[model samples]
Target: MTGISKLLMTLGVIIFVVGFLMQFISLGKLPGDILVKKGNTTFYFPIVTSILISIILSAIFYFIGRFR
Candidate 1:
């Protein structure tokens, strides 16, 4: 890769990391008159969902690359 491409890639990665971390810095419930609420919630597993998506996508790419 060229130097410019490498620099852009590094910047992209830094931005992604910062954006992801900022999510936790929020005071979920501030002096808001009313906090967010949930009702009749079903199973909502984010970790599992992300894991499954990653696994499936990786497997798909692996198979596709096998043909090349």
Candidate 2:
């Protein structure tokens, strides 16, 4: 397959694996995430989760680039 196709396939597999693992792992509740509750309002932000995913994706892309 071409480079783009290969990259896309790799990403698809990564996404599938992450989705599958999410069922067993609760990344949303990580310690540093923000949660707010008011009388009738609630707000949540997965800041830690976002950072963790960013780091993981960065590492994955770095390896993928190295191998390309």
Candidate 3:
């Protein structure tokens, strides 16, 4: 397989694993996440979750790059 195909497959597997874990994990409700409610309206944002995911992915890529 080509480089692009390998990258795509890796991404697909990562997405599948994340989706499966999300079914059993309450990541969206993590602390530092924002939740605003007004009368009949509500808004939510997972800032902490995003940052944590970013850091985790960064480390993963860093290690992968080092190995490569």
Candidate 4:
């Protein structure tokens, strides 16, 4: 398969794994994440979770690139 196809497949599998884990883990609700509530209004942002995922993915891709 081509590079784009390989990337998409990797992304799909990552998403699937994350979704499956969400059933047992509370990822987005961690401390340092943002959640706003007002009269009849609500907002949410998983800042910490995003940072954690970015770090993990960065490490993963860094190793992959080093090997390749």
**Quick one: best lDDT, which candidate?**
2
Candidate 1 per-residue C-alpha lDDT over 1-68 given as tens digits, one digit per residue, 9 for 90 to 100: 59678667655875686579768755323343243347864443355445655785587557645654
lDDT of each: 0.57, 0.92, 0.85, 0.84
Clashing pairs in 2: none
How close is every model to the real structure, measured as TM-score? 0.36, 0.83, 0.68, 0.66
Put down candidate 3 lDDT per residue, 1-68, tens digits, no spaces: 59778778777987898789889988778989999999999999989999999997998678666755
**CA displacement after TM-score superposition, residue 68 of candidate 3 (Å):** 1.6
Which residue ranges in model 2 land beyond 4 Å of their true spot? none
Worst 10-residue lDDT window, candidate 2: 21-30
Better of 1 and 2 by lDDT: 2
Report the number of backbone clashes for model 2.
0
lDDT of each residue in 13-53, candidate 2, tens digit only: 98999899889997888999999999999999999999999
TM-score of 4: 0.66
Which model, 2 or 3, shows the larger TM-score? 2
Q: Rate residue 36 of model 4 by lDDT.
A: 97
